[model samples]
Target: MIRHLVLFKLNEGVSRDEERVRAGVRAFQALEGEIPELSFWECAWNITDRPIAYDFAVNSAVADTDALKRYLEHPAHQAAAAQWREFATWVIADYEF
Candidate 1:
């Protein structure tokens, strides 16, 4: 399996309360069972207020690199990513397990 993790950081002057941000987060949360290539999915808002803490996170797993690619290219995922791109930046890491 492959673990695909992401940490989100709100852009300068952007607040988590903004409609765009909320919608984006919702979109991500809604993908748990929507994508066939995803074996696991979790999207969440951060509870910590520390400067080093990211504003949101996505922890997901896939069957392999090919499945991960499909998940990344899926239209739903692309749309959700587009929404997030409007208000935040993100970092991602992938590893086999």
Candidate 2:
């Protein structure tokens, strides 16, 4: 399986508690059932108080690279990412496990 992980840090003036951010987070959370290639999907707000911690995260798994590609290219994923781009910056990693 391919484990795809992403961490998002809100932009300089963005707040996690704000309505817009929460809505964007919910948009991503809703993708679990929308994308057929995803074998596992989890999205959450960061609870840690550390300065280095990201504001939000997504941990997902897919059958293989092809499935991972499908997940990334899915319309729902693209839309959610475009929305998130407005208020955050993110980093991602993918690996076989």
Query: Residues 1-97, candidate 1, lDDT per residue (tens digit)?
Result: 9999999999999998888888898999889899999998998999989989999999999999999999999999999999988889999999999
Estimate TM-scores for all models.
0.97, 0.96
Query: For candidate 2, which ten residues in a row score worst on lDDT?
Result: 14-23
lDDT of 2 by residue, 1-97 (tens): 9999999999999988889898898899899899999999999988888989998999999999999999999999999999999999999999999
Top TM-score prediction, candidate number: 1
Which stretches in model 1 have alpha-carbon errors above 4 Å?
A: none
**Location of the lowest summed lDDT over 10 successive residues in candidate 1:** 16-25
